[model samples]
Target: MENTIFSLIPPFLAIIMVVLTRRVLLSLGVGIVSASLLLANFSLTGTVSIIYDAVKGIFVSEGSLNTSNIYILLFLIILGIITSFITISGGSRAFGEWAITRVKSRVGAQIVTIFLGIIIFIDDYFNALAVGQISRPITDRQKVSRAKLAYLIDSTSAPICVVSPVSSWGASIIALIGTILATHNITEYSAFSAFIQIVPMNLYVWATLAMVFIVALRNIEIGPMKIHERRAVKEGLVSDPNKPAVDKLQEDLPTSKKGSVGDLVWPIIALIVGVVGTMFWTGIVGSEGNVSLLAVFENTDVNTSLIIGGLLGLAVTIGFFIRQVLVYKSVDKSVFKKGVWAGTKSMLPAVYILLFAWTIADLIGRLETGKYLAGVVEIINLNHSFLPLILFVIACVMAFSTGTSWGSFGILLPIAGDIAAATDISLLLPALAAVLAGAVFGDHCSPISDTTILSATGAGCNLIDHVMTQLPYAVISALIACFGFLVIGFTGSTTLALLTIVVLLILFVIITSRRTKEV
Candidate 1:
């Protein structure tokens, strides 16, 4: 009993610290330290040994910087470099300028912004920054609140990427599913197969997308976000208090080189082509020449594909530089360095977050906390007929605590997958869907979530401000998803269940819009 209680201490403390401090790194550090202290308390060697071991385990253990985490971090850095290059070369600005010319109304601008976010569907981190940067000017020009812009960016980032077949998120989910399948002795099951099976069942992903469209089209305003939206309409985009006034001056100054639609369109095309080509070559061509696309995804790993895509992005950047230099009859070294610096700097925060998340996961695993937690979950009634709802809540809680959808999925997939297999449940679809939905729920709501922070940063909104404003909508969506899962679990009709939620959510948004108008 005492040991069980001690085991729960770290996670509880971690949650409290995050809620109190709202600093992810600090919260993670506190969680790790608390876990170490608890482990020491349980062990004969006491607190010092536990602390030393935890620190040493991170640096010295092979498990600490394993292949998957290393690959993810490397990909993040590469993506950062690529994005930075694009931004420095004025691609993002060009896109924004082009969007402003094309979009006629504030509503149209918001819809287009959300549409572009949906189309990107590559990486959430990339989506968050890229969409925010590209659309910020357009949203600003239209008098849309920065908070609303951040919400749009945040809404699309994880939700769309998680559901897309040709993205980093797709790759991670597939890999996790594959791990689950292999662990459960299901050799016939594949990641892509599992992904397709679960995609329809991913209530939160579909519902969130539905909510985005409904909110945009109906112009629904609720909670703290409603207040911010009204305020921004009255006063204009709020400047960041932390940034220097000089930065504001630079942003306000007029530009000599205005970007055209072609400048924006071609690069985006090139990026999409590169990503698709790489995935096709690696997933389709490399396998049996005639396998289905879904089969290929199940069989192939997307990390390698993304690396290829990054190289392709580099090539495209080089081509753009050449074209510019030749067209102008001049070359500037400063421009090249500027692109590199921008990409590197933009990616630094993600890199740091990844490293810290990895270290914390490793530390927790070493202390056997995750395993023990897994056992405790199994020991409970989490595997019953209503297991789907249990899994949903568990996933949401884990993800909320961890501040990462990916990490939450990583932790819960195996446990949920195994339980699903043992119970003769069609575990592949619902289990995977539950984890995915839960991760998004947590990612959406957690104040410390990296994507949430990135959304705020990209939109130039306050971090806490974004969190407070966004929470109510996220809660509503999560509750709806939870109810949807319950219906699916009982009736085994995922499509109907999701459709019902969609209709209900749409109605809710329309009604809310009317209510706001009346108020």
Candidate 2:
């Protein structure tokens, strides 16, 4: 019943198993069962009881299946519905067509790809698949390598989502941070506060995003990316065999209406406005009209606001879909129901995955894994200045191995928060930021990451080629992030750290460029 070194085994073992088998669900199940066994003191009956208790805890427990988490789940469901509506209505195809006509050059094509990648800030999987599928044709016509496009899609997908405040990634991050804080009985802080504060410290995400634009705007390439670009331009070979051609995920039904760009644009804008507005509205309402906007944000429930936004977006999408159907008469009325049902069905699996993640994370807490890991940190007694970089590296390694940033977050954040609180509370945001940034960095380059695979699939390139070509660029951004974290860890000045990273990246790009290819 006491916290011990063994408490850490389940998380680490799960990570190892994930790395070896590339099986997230199995790995997570194994972790939960293993922890349950240990908590049962290795008794089979006791372990079963533990599992039962955990299941009960998720739904019946007071806080585990509470309002906040429920809303978060609802938000995801609505998000899926919106995405399905977009695809089945032919909104995606219409937008892609509209976008390509304005692209007068290769740079313009790549820029549009990057722009689309950045703005798609919903889910990483969606971002990758959408950007890659939509932009690939334009890139191919412009002679840009599928590898480059994959890199663009892969890099932008996670990086943008992880930073976007209204995204699924943001919800996951908030939920994780909040759960950890609650477990620690740290009521003085808010997850939203931490989420907002940590943004500046998330150097890897910023660096990765910046690197994509740098690559796009500067017309340069490095390492294998350079060679791939050369091959594409000179040989007119766009696809790379190293990349696996993953079949496009089928929509509920083909669209007959041929949706306009406005169809895609309007829903997303409504979603964004809804999310932002509801956040403030909830914040103000929670504070009883006696707090600043920041205070309200730090006090309001993000899960509720996000759910509201998602629902609002869904309503807007439904309205638009009906209007289009009335005007164009393109698709049958039955198509709408099928699209909604399909979207809802697609998200159920993901929602279940999140629940499983929550269960395992709870198991870790029950096992006192955080205290065990924090004890080890205390034993090392490393300088607080080194903690950010150390935590960043650890997070990156965990995420890279598991190919699941969410898992890495669930495992590391509570422990990191524990270590920081027990050592110096000031390091809390930095530690969280480090873990978030590192997890994203690892997920970006990980061969097994869903986003990475989807990027390759969407671009119709070999998966391995995307991985290999993107590696150098990912490493460069990571290295820069590492240095920036180190500086910020020591000085506590994000401005200086960001400035240093900017200079370093500019120099690297300028020094590394041989001759810019037309592609």
Candidate 3:
């Protein structure tokens, strides 16, 4: 089954089960077991060994600690603690009350969340969690559903990073492009220049961003998202009460009446500073003294930076927590232990989901799923003009199946370059751009995607609910982007493609608005 059509079964099974059952962990477990069985040829003992090795690999790879995964998990735990402390200190409550006076409308709240997500484009992980902590209070106060907030965060994080030259995503993609360019002996453009050129050609990023803004500004709601939004507005039920949320706090925690917005604002600011500072330090140290901007980004240790920053944020939050109990005397000192336990417990759901997700993703890699998809792309004898569109679709399937955009990029970008170079070197950048766009599009829609998981965690939304609610919007954006890629493929005119996106989005928003009002 490895590296063949059978390699596709595990992911499809996981996706189908999750959609039908809305049970994330159970579905992932089934996928994991099925994948292990396939790899082991249905031998129970061999399957056990494969599963054990895959699980072990998540924490221990190449006889060393998998610091990337460990650090990200640690960051989530620390972030959950900080969120709990913020609430217990009354920072969330105070901030929401404060913002209600200023924001005044649900649309204003959602727009603020959208803009914050766009502005924090350094890394998707940081963007998703940090933006949620900052914007959740205001959005909740305005009765905006957690699902919508998760959608906003997920939509902006990847799309912005994919396009921005300064982001981690850009650095990774540029490095890949550099290798691809070198392999093809294409000397007309540098990787940095190619990345810039490819930016406009990434029509999905544009289409997604357009839809994000239009949805915020026009109050457009579609599919499951509409149901969520309607419930939030009419009943003030921002989340499904029966569902478990990664960011859900314990009930009846003691809150300090004296807590101010500064308690919340300062900790988050410290977090950002600490994270960006650590990124620079790690980048410079790794660069061996040649610390150019792109070089810094390329060499930066993202997971390590996240944990260091998370620690700083946690420290500040603890300080505020102590102040609430010790100084203000509004919160009981006895609540300290419960607060800590509550915070840790809140994040366990997300952690368990991530662990399973990582395990299955690793097992899927062992199945050579991406390699099979890339092979399919390479063997297709399509027209040169259709290369971008074809690569986009293949990348979507590959990333969706593997549940990782970077994995798709690692496997597909080089193949795309090879195909485009042999057929039409001029289409190389567009083709690569299409891969980037499609990978993100797939990541957005995949329930098993880490970014998708973290987005729901950060927003305090149900995981499956976030996946289902955001699917319709992601599909619409992808369809528009598909058309854009087709236009760019044949006409090689980004302006024309962008114009089409704008016109289509306008029609979509108008149509959605009328339908929403009628409902």
Candidate 4:
């Protein structure tokens, strides 16, 4: 069966279903079954076979057994364990009690959340759960909307990870770049050099971060976000208290009498230190004396390194809990195993959604959705000036439809790379950079995105509310990024273009601030 534009029906159908019914799981299920039907040539029996095969592959064979999946599973379990242990030890409660005093205003609480997000930049998952556990209670007390808290949490998660070179996200990106470059036999640029070059060109990421700060700092709310904020302020409703919260682990573990700031602070610090240190050790041992940080990332097995680091962090949490029980006699030693089990159970929903989302993404690839999209560019004779902008838009639309940034990167990077190879080789970095930026932008808006799910879970917000409230801000930042990209496309100067984005971002803040006052 030939893959055509019709291959795109599944994702669109999924998005529409989610919009109409607000049922993410059902929407995704429909997407998978419908897409399977298409792949099976519309035979009902064939669709059943396709579904069974996909389930087996994801759970029984390739998907679960793959190195990347193993690492992620291990990391998730350890993360669950660490968060549960710390929360049960009363660290989360103590931190909230301590933070509430200093963070008296909503702006103060948001700034604290932003800083907490930046400080824990090793992995987006770590940042999402840790920041959410620690910040939600404080934000709630300050009457900040769950949507607003979710927006801050979501923005910082993937965007922060993407920018930081020492992160798991960076490792995946570098590996992808290396694989594509090797496969294409392109020697004009080294992966390391190219990745470094691509960072500055990633406009959507930096712009999104800037938007988060501006929104938090100046108290600018528009669209659905405005309604939420106004409701929070006027009615004293921070979020839907009735909604099922993602912070169940925080409650299930049960707080202890020996609550203190040290309980929360040390465990998080240990996790950071353990992950970074282990990553370095793994890289050094693998590199055989290649000490450059990026070299270690390039040489190191990312899955193995993260799992080891997560284990070390888990060990630290266990040790802290045991000592707390012995010293303070205020903690329960019994909660340890049950807490870990409960935490692991909580992540199953997220895990299933991730697997299904991956399945949809795979189907999209087999169907050549990106190729169909890339063909649009192939026909047009775009010059250098319009090329980056066009590539950015394609990447955005493709990524938005698919609801996965890395998947979009996997599909679009190679095509964009090919386009660059055929045209001016200088377009290589910019083209790749454009894909990275636009993918993150689109993922920001996607309800089914794994990062978005984690963000909602971490912040204890309704997922639909998070998606609705954050979309406007994401669009504004993306529009600004598009403008900056156009400036770069025309002038071929990254500095000037970046400056233009910053200037526009500042102007947007000022204008919105004045508008809010007037209203």
- Which numbered prediction scores highest in lDDT against the true structure? 3
Against the true structure, candidate 4 reaches a TM-score of: 0.89
lDDT sort, best first: 3, 4, 2, 1
The sequence of per-residue lDDT tens digits that candidate 1 reaches over residues 1-519 is 123545556656765776677565687677767766665655646655766665555445655544444554555555555545444445557766666777867788789789878987766765775576567767877777777888888999899988887676786678778777777777665677778878888898787887778777777777777777776677774443442210111222122143334444455456556656766666676566568665465455455655665566667765665555556434454566655555556555545544555555545555544345446557776435566777787777766655667777777788888787778456457866887898888878765566776677567566556777777778888888888888887777887778779777877877786787788
| Candidate 4 lDDT tens digits, 81-196 | 77778777887788878888888999999998998888878667668766876788789778899889999998988888877777767877887888778877888788777788
Best by TM-score: 3
Per-model TM-score versus the true fold: 0.76, 0.68, 0.98, 0.89
lDDT of 2 at 78: 77
**Could you give the C-alpha RMSD of every candidate to the true structure, in order shown?**
5.1, 6.7, 1.0, 3.1
Per-residue lDDT for 145 in model 4?
91
Candidate 4 error regions (>4 Å): 60-64, 171-190, 231-237, 247-253, 285-291, 323-327, 331-342
Write down the lDDT of every candidate, Cα atoms only: 0.67, 0.74, 0.91, 0.79
Candidate 3: stretches off by over 4 Å? none
Q: Write the per-residue lDDT of candidate 2 for residues 1-519, one digit (tens) a residue.
A: 536877767777776675566555687789889989989999999999988888677666664456765775676677767777776677766775776677767788898898998887755755665566467657877789888998888888888878766666776678778887787777776877778878888999888888888888886687778788988888888765443243322344666556887777677777767766776677678675568644454455656766777777788878778876787787778787788777777566445555665677667778865445435544666789888898888778656644567777777888888888888777788888998898898778765455665577557666567777898889999999999989988998889889989999888776756444332
Clashing pairs in 1: 84-343, 192-298
Model 4, CA-based lDDT: 0.79
Better of 2 and 4 by lDDT: 4
The model with the greater TM-score, 3 or 4, is: 3
